[model samples]
Target chain A: MAKYSKFAAVGLLLAFPLLVSSDYYRHIMILALMWVVIGSSWNLLAGYTGQISFGHAIFFGVGAYSAGLCTTKLGISAWWGMLIGGPMAMLFGFVLGAICFRLRGTYFNLATLALAEILRLVAKSWVSLTEGMMGILTIQTFRSKVPYYYLAFGIAALCVFAIWAIIRSKWGYYFVAIREDQDAAEHLGISAFRYKSISLLVSSFFTGVAGAFYMNYMGFIDPDVVFSLYYISIMAILVAIIGGAGMIWGPPVGAFIMVLLQELFRSAFFGYLPKWISEAHAMAFGILVIVVIRFMANGVVGDWVKLSGLFTRQKAPIPSVTSGN
Target chain B: MEMFIQMLVAGILIGGIYALIGLGMTLIMGVMRIINLAHGQLMMVAMYITYVLYFYLGIDPYFALLVAMPALFLLGVAIQKYFLNPLLKIDSIIPQNQILMTVGVGIVLTETIRFIFRSDYKSVKTSYSSATFMIGNISWNVPMFVAFGLAVALTAGLFIFLLKTDAGKSVRATAQNKDAAMIMGINADWITQLTYGLGAAMAAAGGTLLLPIYYLFPDVGSQFTLKAFIITVLGGMGSTVGAIVGGIVLGIAETLGATYISMDLKDAFGMVIFVVVLVFMPGGLKELTKV
Candidate 1:
């Protein structure tokens, strides 16, 4: 029954666009799917590997610019970014890890953040290379949302599966071991730096793909939109964190919740609420972060039993052999 | 040579203010073992307080400092007590939960300010704002000179407090070892609260001082937050004197960068220096000073 749920969820998602005719809902789903890719990748690095990155936007922006530049410079279809973006981001990931993996915890976080800021600044100023703040614009290849929706769905599914596979693999254990205690992992002869870089590589690749997908779907790119610390970097963290970090299902759950919340606020609850409520969207994200961190440290999925128990007004059931397995 | 001296003097003057900001972060880092990522947001809140007092009440920014500092101290104490302290007891996968909380707090603070002030670029224009005096070949902005003097005086006062006060000793002790401090009957919880308050107050003072010369916006806190941490890192995580020197160095580097290396890349200079310092001299200036 539990094994079939994954299939059920995927099947439902695959059929979602077909069931829902509204372009509005389709666009929201596409955004949610994109976030799944970004959030899951972030989880793989920060949640599983204990390398909390505050600059996932660096890879994200690189992936975005990789696609955007292909159109502007290479004079190719932006679709090529779908192929090139991941690797381009992975390249950045390698450099970032090489420079930053030497530092631990907060220092690593700061380094990633600082590097991303540098990139944002460069992307804004280097007019010859990046078109500066003018941004890269391209015509959307598909007028129908279905094609983009499916692409986003496919990428998200692939990313989740890859992360799931990695976590189940020996590499996953090494990552977790490093997260638990780097010194202990080292004592056990696991090269912390090597595995961390590998985790970052995979993470950046998927995130880069998402960024590229964003370019193709949105049909436009800007430094402020792509490399924004508040909108992209922190949003990725919020997604992984809101869903429950360290769990395979966490980011997917979180991505949906966040995107839905964002849209609801952005549209002022489908025009029911006052427009002023829409302006408070970022503030809402901030408050959600605080609330989640305060009461639900492990997030909804991680504390499912406790959460459900509250609804049922019953003691959270202790896991029996069948349930535990 | 005159231009060089001008830049140097300007750097030192601004560096004094940066030192005050860095001192706040250093104190928090020393005591809490966590980087108060919202250090600059706290300063921003203080700046807003000062701004309100100046704009609405016709009070001087320097005078506004009295209200801003204590108000921010209380705000900081409340945050430490409620938001950060509880996280210490919660079992979570992420060890940097407190730091993450600070980020959330920073966002909320910035957004709240934006909601109120609407992201307008505001500055407190005083009669002395543009007043200057010539000394030798270099002309000094009067406000900058006064701000520098106030920063020095605050630093001196802080040093005396830390060295002479029993409460300050307890703070240092708690920073050294929380468990040991608890065993010694010092209220580690209260000390953490007090340290956070002091850190916030110092940042508030720095912000209040900067109000005359610098422009204010909701997003300004983030830039200072980056600068504060950079200064803290450069000074060596928990070293006060090191932070002061680091601040001055950053001030000089930024001014020089602005003059010679495109004015736009001035902020980048600090970041480049930060990465360089992290890579080569992880110990920061503290390794050399060892104070």
Candidate 2:
């Protein structure tokens, strides 16, 4: 009964906002949903598999470019563009995984960053396809934010459900085991490479679709925005760390909190601040993640669940608790 | 032939700076096994410090180094002691947590720098900052030469420090095997802190040294940081010697490749080296650590 009430409350909150939405609030919602998908996808790899990629923007760029290119150049439907983009991103993800998986520690991170930068450079220089740094203009932006809001929400829901399914399956267990101890998992007959790559593929698919979503909504696509390692990788890490990455609800919760915080700060500062402050604000967001992770360790959501268990008289069960230090 | 030689010389000069950047990273990674995304930010901060001394106080870039190094070294020590030491408590620190911790420090550092010192590009101006010497058909910039020379000097100093001092032995012992060294009455904490400070100081040195030639901005850290990382991997994760040599090779290869290969694919060429190295030999010029 309590669980049902909890669900009902959440449903009401979600439903109540949709009934009446200002353009500003609606814009915020569209962004929040978009991030939910991207952040969840990032958490899938960094949170679960323990790969710690700083190069996810490459996959996002691939999807955006592929989708954008298809629509503009070939005059293809976004439906077909998305269909092609997902596989294209997956293919790239598989190759990236296979290549960089051998590198232990920071080498992987550095290599991933380099690859993302390479993709950004490709998107910028290859004017014929990506339309250069000026980027793809005149993209299809809709009148009502409802379709975008729902599409983003649906994709995010799908990602959460997909990750949840994985958690229930052997694959998720393998990821957890390997994340804890790679050698031990290998000893236990789990192919670390295979599972890692599979998780990456799953992560990339959503990221690509999110990229497609981004191009459609923003009405402008640039190498900087699409290939922006700044947006995809750093923001994903922030969401994952803050929300207690590696758990089903981690990224979404983190994304909501972070996006909300940014909005609050940006609005609060208003015209009083300079553009540098705004850029610095993004950096501040990243710093907040680091500070929280440094101190909180298990991250915000992870800690919440842990703390809740301690206070409850009956060891109030909150599932796995995003188990961490 | 003239263009090729000029690029080669230029690459070698830039390679020296890359080596300097990689050396500090290798030193920390060898001991700590954590990636400091803040490495570049620290360097940027150091450069800004150097810039202030030079631009505001009218200190020479070389004298600014004296100020930058010690300041960064202390900042490095404090960060490691307060922030990183705690994070390194567990056996193997969580990869993502390390990312957050380092990048957290990085973002804060980068943002604070950008906040304090606007996004405008600041370069150290010496009469010699841009003065270039000509040799037959080849020209060499004084700032580049000084930076390159300093890179060599710093590497030598680091080698001597690691080899000569009692603390150096502790550092080496800890780097090789943390548990074994811990058993040997070596204070891993002290060694780790000192090593980090040393590494951070080296970055400050690089920052100040490269300030004349390279542009200083809050975001400039990302560029050198990424390049330093590539050099670190190419040379060897933990090998100091490997980093220097790898820096030169990478410098020359990419420099030459940019002209010979399509400039559009210049970055891809560097990435090609990374991918090739990872696939064929994950260690590149350096041997893999057995740990």
Cα RMSD (Å) per model? 1.8, 3.2
In CAPRI terms, where does candidate 1 land?
medium
Predicted candidate 1 versus true structure: per-residue lDDT over A1-325, tens digit per residue: 7589978988999999999999999999999999999999999998999999999999999999999999999999999999999999999999999899999987888889889988898888888988888899999999999999999988998999999999888999999989989999999999999999999999999999999999998988999899998889988988887888888888899999999998998899989999999999889878887888887777667777888889898797764432100
Residue A193, candidate 2: C-alpha displacement in angstroms: 2.5
Query: Ten residues in a row with the worst lDDT in model 1 chain A?
Result: A316-325
- lDDT per residue (tens digit) for residues B131-156 in model 1: 99999879999999999999999999
Worst 10 residues of 2 chain B by lDDT: B90-99
Poorly placed runs, candidate 2 (over 4 Å): A13-17, A269-279, A305-325, B90-93, B262-268, B288-291
Q: How is the predicted docking of candidate 2 categorized under the CAPRI scheme?
A: medium
Candidate 1 local lDDT, residue A242: 81
| lDDT minimum window of 10 residues, candidate 2 chain A | A316-325
lDDT of 1: 0.91
TM-score of 1: 0.98
- What clash pairs does model 1 have? none
Candidate 2: residue A5 lDDT (0-100): 65
